[model samples]
Target: MDLPQSQLVAAHVQECNFVQIIEGLVDSSHLGFLHIDTLRKSDSSDLAYAQNVNSMQHALAPKIGVEDTAFGFYYAALRDIRKEGESRLQARVAGFIAPFTVLNPNGDLHQLVIPMTDTRSMFIHVYSASRRRSTRSRYAVSTCGWWAWTARHCSDFT
Candidate 1:
């Protein structure tokens, strides 16, 4: 059977599919690096470039909370798993996501772990469309790079 649409329409459709695949691949590729630094170390990948903590200490550390607040406060609290250490370490996470649009899912932007079941797990992500002030502050190199990758994919998601 002969098609009525022009060749340009077919080309456009293919282009759109290509873009979606690229975006999806980028999303999935982020999982390994974002979830853990283990893969990066074994592969000698630059993905494990966190500057603030040494690998040995990081391995022993319990958990770290990264937080940003409406009062223009942002910080990270490092908890010691051993509980033997009295001091807690902390730092401010860079950049702010505008309100009503990109605020953290649980009044916070991200969470490392949430248990859904005995074996299965769930991770929830919340994104908004509201606009807010941009500080133009210098963000960490890794953060900036991820933002750049996401920005490109945002055209499809947004």
Candidate 2:
């Protein structure tokens, strides 16, 4: 859904909040460590995961081309899952930490973190996706698991 541009502009003007900077620090390498235990054992980082990343990068390079600059890391690795089929699905825990926006600028099923203040933050995350399930179903199952995982491991965030 498109945010009414007017609302975004208003938020920027009112000092309700301004400026959102997104940093992409996690990659396949980091995923292995960050999600190893949290994710299902079959989904953990391994030779399969690296190959998946490489395959995705290769597929996306032709369509979107490759951007090899400072801003490019964010766009890197756009995989084509159709080739992989239904064996295992890969998902990113992405987040949009914004000053005011409630919904993620990037759809659901990725980790979305919104920071309200320096020390305090609100996190909305998507845990997984499945070809077998509808969007709503995938989100419900994944979100619950994600919330439970975060509550147990991420004490600092609380």
lDDT of 1 by residue, 1-158 (tens): 25332211000011123333333222322323344555335444332232222232333433435455674333333333232565544332332333212222123233222233332222223322222222224222222132112122223345
Clashes of each: 5, 5
lDDT of each: 0.29, 0.31
Model 2 lDDT per residue over 1-158, tens place = 45332221111111111122233222333333444443344444464333334333323222222233333222332334454454333343322233322222123234334455553334443323221122332222222233222122222221
lDDT for residue 154 in candidate 2, whole number 0-100: 26
Assess candidate 1 and give its TM-score to the true structure.
Answer: 0.24
Highest lDDT: which candidate? 2
- Give per-model TM-scores: 0.24, 0.31
